[model samples]
Target: MALKQSFSQKMEQKLSPQQIQLMKLLQVPTMELDQRIKEELEVNPALEEGKEEEEDEFEQEEYEEEIGEDERDFDIDEYLTDDEPAYKTSVSNKSKDDEEKSMPLSSGKTFQELMLSQLNMQKLTEKEVLIATYLIGSLDDAGYLERDLESIVDDLAFSQNVMTTEDELEGVLHYVQELDPPGVGARDLQECLILQMERRQDGDITRYTALKILEDHFDEFVKKHYKKITAKMEISEEDLKDAVHEIIRLNPKPGGSLKSSSKSLQQVVPDFQIVDEDGKLVLSLNGRNAPELKVSQGYKKMLQNYSEGAKLQKKDKEALTFVKSKLDSAKWFIDAIQQRQNTLFSTMTAIMNYQKDYFLTGDDTELRPMILKDIAEIVDLDISTISRVANSKYVQTQYGTFSLKHFFSESLSTDSGEEVSTREVKQILLEAVEDEHKRKPLTDEKLASLLKEKGYNIARRTVAKYREQLNIPVARLRKEL
Candidate 1:
């Protein structure tokens, strides 16, 4: 078949750079917005901190008009040469293997560093130290060393120029596991718990029994088959309960304890604050969300000087173009930030009004059925835009700080055929689970039946889903001696 010549025209809707910037800014929470602004100020010389000047608009228009009159060839896109493809210049020249990719490690003492510090404190030979270092570095964020001893042996030989056997590695690993946080060098969940219990045994029968249970019948313990464990271990119900208690007290994620020390404390700054001003709700965007940013007046003066010249030199045109680009960028960024604040406030205000009763009463049952589209329609924006506002952003209320996402829930019909928020149902489910007898915890079916008794008409699967979402385990797992 021969191809036919084709001449067709089509239009595509695309996000402009400014729009893209606004969308991204909309997702930035209050705490990080300051850092993001500082980064922008560093890159764009035309942007400056402090309140935007009142005369900035008039001066900017003057400079822009001057540039329009002269320097017709002064275009920012001119920097992109026709000889180089735009995408190619923006992309990496190195192959995937050649690229140096670094993991984003936490600040302060890392998990590896903590182990190494402990290693230094202990008396170990040079070879042992290197092997232990490798092992510590191999531990994942969860604190478990998931690699096999054989593979680690091979790795030490090939990468670290160290020779070792599985037996020697095990010896070093035993010492490593003895370090802080208790379970830093275990290979799996069972080993992690056993390592922790080993430190806490203290010759107590409960701890001893717990260690034995973990060492032998870990599967049975996990499955809640207490009868089988009591039969095999030949322990009484009270002894088994004490053993289980000891096991439960142990940290499942030993590395997680290290993470707090290795990372700085994160403070959540609400992006919006809603106040109950006598029966009326008043919404205000966080002051940080609306920073005073303006294009540098110095850059504007330079452009004005260039534009005033009678004749244009190539260098002059280039300098003018550069200043214009910076000024334009700074202006765009400032506008994008303002739009972000407006978008956030409007979206959150709509949500506050939509769930007015909930915000007023601090009761989950008062929240109305709402989704992204409901607020999107109210704000005359896209669902995705509303989602972005709801993503990392939080709002401060009379009750407490909550994510914007907390206010939005899918609707669930009640026995009265009235639509209610799934959040309300989850609240009821949570109360039921919390109040249920631990000796015989409520099942998903039982929970659903209870919700129906309270007028929430949801299915068993949904109840199970909600239970899991609440981080509640099954009834069997919830059972105790």
Candidate 2:
């Protein structure tokens, strides 16, 4: 085959660097946006913090004429002018004290570190310590030993060249399980519960009864077959209730109890705030989302001085190019931030307006059916842009702070040919479950029938799907004696 040249022309859509920056800025929350601005300010010396100065229109126009319009997309003088919108506001996502002061970093030991500290205190040999350390590393965030002992044995022999057997590892694990925060190092849920119960096995009848229930009838207990358990254990319902009360109080996620296991506890900084003033809803963007920024005045003066030089030199031209690049970058960043504020405010405004009834009443049933497309249409932006505005962004209302993604849900039809948000149906299902009689919880089919009586055209399978989405378990597990 031989290479050949052909002429083909096709129109394409590509985002400019400024557009890409705006898109990225839209996705960052208020807390991150502040850090991002600091990074940009550090890297670009031409950008600075603080209020912009009021410049004379004649001077600004002259500066614009000096920096030719054909060389760049935006005028630097426009970004430096004081007439720009006041982006900074008083409200913050945190409390007034939080805004004044920041929380100190945590200096706490991780789960593995705590486990190793306990292991070191135990009477174990050097090689056993390494194996126990490896075992500590294998536990998940929930504190369960996810890997099997046989695989760990093979891994130790193959990777570390430390010959070990299943029985040996099991013996070491017994000591690990005895560490603080009970139920950690267990293989599965059953084992985790059993480990916790074994630690609490005192001479008391209630404690022994709970241990026996866990040790023998764990499967029956897990399935919530209360009658079968009562019959098998030869215990009354009151006695079984007391025993289960003990088991229920045990921590299932012992590893999660570690302060360090929560990777990073991010303080939620909402991007927007909504207030109801005499039944009218008002929305405002967070102060950090639209930080105060301006091009460095010193850099601007440097450009003016270089341009006003009597005679131009090669070095002067290079300096002018360098300063111009920094100014351009600063201008682009300021413009992107402004556009992000507009896009964010517009998208959220549409969402708030659409769900006005819900926000006003603080009722989940009042929420209207909404999606990214709906907000995109109202804001006249792309669906993905609306999605970015919704992602990882929260809004504070009188009721509580909620993620923007929480407002958008799929639509379902009613018997009266009306469209309702699935959120409304889920709210009803949640209320039904909450008010249910524990002696005989309603099944999915019964839930569907009840919804049908309420004029919500839902099917039995659809009820089951909605129930699962709400994290409501089956009727069998829901039943209580």
Candidate 3:
């Protein structure tokens, strides 16, 4: 066979660098936008946080001349088109004095820092401290030392050039496990609970029996096999219940308790706020989402000086090129941010209007059937773009703060020939399960019959699928004494 050349043509779509940047920027929530802007500011010295002044008029002219009509076409009017409102105000029902405010500062030491401080209090040799530090680093977010001792020994020997034995590591680990969090260095859930139990001041029989169960019958205990446990341990049902209650009281996640104190707790920042103003729904972008950004005037001035200079040396030309590149990047970033704001506002506005009934009534049952395609068509954007806008973004409504994706649900038809949101069906399903008898929970077949009685003609398998989506277990798993 011989190589041959053939002519073929196909239509293709390509995203420019600025378009790619805008897509990525659109996906980040309000809480993370500030950090992203700060990262860009650090990398591109030509970017800054302030209003663009008139002093950079000469530089702006030169920049426009350097870049052609394609760049010039990227104006604010292009993004803020006819579909956008002229003056979209944020309406609030509360008076100015009743507005909620957030604390500007938070102060606390991290979990690792607290652990290290405790480690410093111990009177250990240099080698032992090194081993302990390695083990501490190996602790996961849940405060469990997930790495095995053999693996940790290898890591220490190879990475830190510190040769150590598993026995020595275990010795250091025991001391680390005594840290303030009570079970910070446990190897597993059982060990974490046991460590916390060991710290109990009262050595009661319940605690003793709980410890014994964990020490031996942990598997049976986890499976909730109360009959087996009571038989093997030769205890009555009430005694087994008391012992199991003691075990339940122990902290399964020892490291999680330190999260708040260690400043690891993350607060959800909504991207949009929908206010109910005089019975009408008003949508507004979060203040953090539309931060004021502009190009640095100093960099603009420098670029102007270089361009206006009579004699251009080799070094001067290179410097001018660098400045121009930075200036272009800064401009692109600012434009991308503005485009992101426009896209978010437009997408959310469409969603709010589409789900206006649900917002007004504050009822999940009132939500209309919608999907990404519907919103994409309304906003004149691609489905993928709409998906990026919906993924991590949150909206604060009068009812509560919810993810943007919550409003977009698949449609289902009832016996009366009316399209309804699947969310409505899920809501009814959730209520039925909550009111169900624990001794005899509703099975998927029974759930389907209940839904049919309520005018929703869903199959048993469909009920099971929706149940799984709502994170509800089966009847057998949900059953209780």
Off by over 4 Å in 3: 1-10, 35-137, 147-178, 201-203, 232-236, 259-266, 293-334, 459-464, 473-479
Task: Sort the predicted structures by lDDT, highest score first.
Answer: 2, 1, 3
Q: Candidate 2 — worst ten consecutive residues by lDDT sum? A: 87-96
Q: In model 1, what are the clashing residue pairs, if there are any?
A: none
Q: Write the per-residue lDDT of candidate 2 for residues 181-230, one digit (tens) a residue.
A: 88989998888988998888779899899999998999999999889999
TM-score for each candidate, following the candidate numbering: 0.84, 0.88, 0.73
Clashing pairs in 2: none
Best by lDDT: 2
Q: So what's the TM-score on candidate 3?
A: 0.73
Model 3: worst 10 consecutive residues (lDDT sum): 76-85
Candidate 3: pairs in clash = none
Model 3 score (lDDT): 0.80
lDDT of 1 by residue, 1-481 (tens): 9989989999999999999998888888877777898899999998887654444223222223334545475543322112112111111222344233223445787777777888877778899999988998898988988889999999999998899999999999888988998877889999999999998878788999999999999999998999999999998999999999999998889998776678866767677778998999988766633456766767766766665555666777778778878877977887777677668778888998898998889999899989898998999999999888899888888899998888878997888999988888998888888888988889999998998898887899999999889999999999887
lDDT of each: 0.80, 0.83, 0.80
